[model samples]
Target: MLIRQLEYLVALGREQHFGRAAAVCYVSQPALSAAIRKLENELDVTIVLRGRRFEGFTDEGRRVVGWAHRILAERDALLADLDRMRNGLRATVRIGAIPTAVPATPLMSSLFSTRYPLARVRIESLSSREISRRLAEFELDAGVTYLDNDTPPGTRSVELYRERYRLLVPADDELARESVVEWAAAAALPHCALMSTMRNRRVLDANMAAAGATLVPVVETDTVGALYAHIATRRLASIVAHTWLHAFGVPEGMCVRPLAEVRPRPAVGLIVSDREPTSIVVDALVDALSGADLSEALERSLPPVIPG
Candidate 1:
């Protein structure tokens, strides 16, 4: 089948609506439908289950879509390789990062851009699971996520740093003057935490559990900015990653204290698909990371947890 036909099929699989998929492919509805039909005839398999509206793909269609993803990814890789040979790394590197890892993304992106000025970098904050799914589906070139757990198979990673925690509290809070706060004490305060769905929240929960404490946050949210707002208003305290301080610094009305109980720091890193004939853009990013000293860079840029 033609590559354009496969493009239409993949877009259809993603959008799940005939009109929307056609729009994505920049084609008329009839044109997209006819191309898929032609593909089906050539393959001798019904790829779509049709009805009054856009029905889901057939069982065989799902298999075809899987192959389509692989083919399109390889095709893009081939084009990228040729472009690099001629133009020297002119492609966008799409990256998905967990929220906790978002602050560190600039370090990686800046390094890549400096090395390959013609290339572009796009970053999205996504859940670790979403990162893994998109990487597997060939939607992302790389990811920044926890490498110690839930890393997808068939991928390799390089650790950037170990993530440590701190208790962020309003400047007027009882523990605000302290250089460190014990987990048990922090858990007892009015606290807002990441939603349980986030892997960072799970890591926080496990760490608290190990410290003979449990977090029952007064409020739960998915974004760090929300947590920061709550603490700034003196509505709650929070356990946040040390990396966050590097991005946001301490909010004007707040301060962060290192957790008194030192636990195992989770390793956060860059992950890329391990399949052969890797994308050139991905290779450039990997090469950039090879010379990066993000761990030390982050530490030096961040003000002390308890400002002197």
Candidate 2:
């Protein structure tokens, strides 16, 4: 089917309303509806359920919508490739990064923009699973997420930096007397750990279990802000990624110390699909990431894994 037809069909699937989808495509409602009908006839499938209002797509229509997404994505990539060939290296770069990695994004973006002044960057915060999915779907040009895990086929990863976990406790706690609180020691204290939903929390739970301590958190939250706010009130202690400590400044009377003997420092890396040819914008980002000293940056701004 024609690319424009696929576009109209995809918009209908997303909008779920003929008038609304037509508005999105900047076409008259009847014109958009006629294009979708043409597409359905060409494919020999009933793509949409007809009614006074747009009801929904049939199972066949849903499958077609999935294909339509990939087709549109590939079309955009092709156009982007052609533009890059005609003009210099300048285009929008879509990126997905894990929550803990957000702090480094601005630094990396600034470095890239300074080097390549003409390009634009769009960043979205997402979980590791979502990042991988988006990368495979060609929705994201690249992603920053935990490495060493099994990556999707036809994608390659490059190590950007190592992310270490730390114990964040109020300064007045008994463990705060020490410069570095061992994992065994910190685990014994009442923890204000992240809820079980976050990967960081899972990593912490595994490490704490090995240290002969079970996390008995007084409070649990998904966001760093919630954890920090609880810690600031002296109501909870938390295990957090060292980078998070950098983004959300450590509270007063808080200590950050590395947890010893945690498996896989959880290297955060940039992942790009091998199937889609890398654009100049992506290449520049890769180059900047490879050369940058992210560890040093983390140390300068981020608090020590434990209170100093």
Candidate 3:
């Protein structure tokens, strides 16, 4: 039926309640419900669950919602194509990135903003698995994350930089005087580590295992701020990506040294959906980043950590 009905259906699926869905669609609940009824009548199938309160969708309704997502996404892409043909590219590009890439998002946002001044951009920090899942669901335009043998299908990747490891040790620590440290030495220290819940941590685990080393962190945190806080103690150290140092200066009393023994470094890159008919906005953003000054974005020199 009407595209508006499909829009309502998709919104309903997203918000999972009639009132909130109507609010998102900028319509009253009654009107939105009537539109859904009409859509079901036209399609000759029951698409919405009939209930006094918000209930889960029926199996068929779920399938319709999936189709609705694809339809609305393609429709928006078509509109973006037309708008770019007549005018310049002007549409919101929502990007999702892993926590490790959060510091790098502004580079992409600024580039997009400069190229298409009128276009809107949003970058959200997410887990790598979440990024890949959202990309497949058409919820994200692109993502920045580690790419390895396990990279998900239906993605077009552009390598940005290799993620190198650095050991952040207190200035007075035994290993602080060294310009470089072996993984075995770093693994033995009482350190703060990113929680294993993250794919980044998993990658680190695999790399350390390969080096015959293991991390037995004194503190584990999900956020960088927390991890940094734990590292404030001269008794603790952390092995982190050098890329992260560009965002947060090294903690107080900490000195960074490259890891001399992690044989291969994992690459971090930008990944977009490989849909057959790619979105115009995705293409434009990729083109903008094609000649990106990655060196600046990849800056990893450790700053002198002042005592806090």
Candidate 4:
């Protein structure tokens, strides 16, 4: 019924715990529960399944939650439109980015901020699948993720760059002497890499397979920082996106080399919902990035690999 009720419902659906949902909505548990009960009474449908705790949403509740997502998104868009009419753009643009794409978000955000100084940008490091899911659910305004593979449906994108792979090794390592490293050779080293669940790791696996190699990482982690830590300590080498080097530079005691085999690199870009009456913040972000030659800019900024 009320917008606040819908907000509480959406938060409950996302958190799946009464206390957590109440905390997110900035209300007491009893207040949030009363709002949901009032909503259910008005709709004449059982929205949530109940037990000692938050069990799950009913089938009808699932549909309601889906509609709630759109409604809240539209409400935000309306506010953004009015703000833009009176002042400059002044809305928070929530973005979910795959870890490999995380490094490149600043390139997009910096451009967005320069144009719309009042607008806020929030970035989250998420898996590719999560980015796709959140965008479809209106939880994310846009995403920075691989555009060439498993792109979310009903969305359009502006390709920023094609991501290339590189091998990272300690300066004292044997492979560090080479100007370029083959995938098979990189695979043979004691490797630390992203977890197999990540799309980036899957991409690396496919490339290595094409090169007659297989990745058997000595350690697997979800974060790039952990991978870098292993390589920096000379405990392991890693195959990582060139964007990582461009963003963070080579870790101390480590050097990067180009991969010898040139496979078709995946395009990483900004993706937003393609439906009519899109979010104004999303539109502003796309406009900010559409004309910029980010690929060239990132290439120019890529840190030089230290000599062996």
For residues 250-276, could you state the per-residue lDDT of candidate 3 as single tens digits? 776677777785546677888998887
The model with the greatest lDDT is 4
Task: Estimate the lDDT of model 3.
Answer: 0.81
How well does candidate 1 score on lDDT at residue 233? 74
Weakest ten-residue segment in model 1 by summed lDDT: 299-308
- lDDT for 274 in candidate 3 is 86
How would you encode candidate 2's per-residue C-alpha lDDT over 224-308 as one tens digit per residue? 6677788888746777777777777777767765556466677877888776455555676787677777777877887444334
The candidate that achieves the highest TM-score relative to the unseen native structure: 1
Q: Write the per-residue lDDT of candidate 1 for residues 1-308, one digit (tens) a residue.
A: 89999999999988999999999889999999999999999999999999998889899999999899999999998999999999889889999999888988888888888999999999999988889888988889999999875788999998888887878787788888777788888888888999999888998888889889999999998998788787677557888887888888877777778887565678899999999877877888889997577889888877676552
Better of 3 and 4 by TM-score: 4
Angstrom error of the Cα, residue 103, model 2: value is 2.5
Better of 1 and 3 by lDDT: 1
Error at 16, model 3, angstroms: 2.3
Per-residue lDDT tens digits for candidate 4, residues 265-299, read 78888899998887899989999999788888888
TM-score of 1: 0.95
Candidate 4: TM-score?
Answer: 0.94
* lDDT score of residue 149 within candidate 1: 52
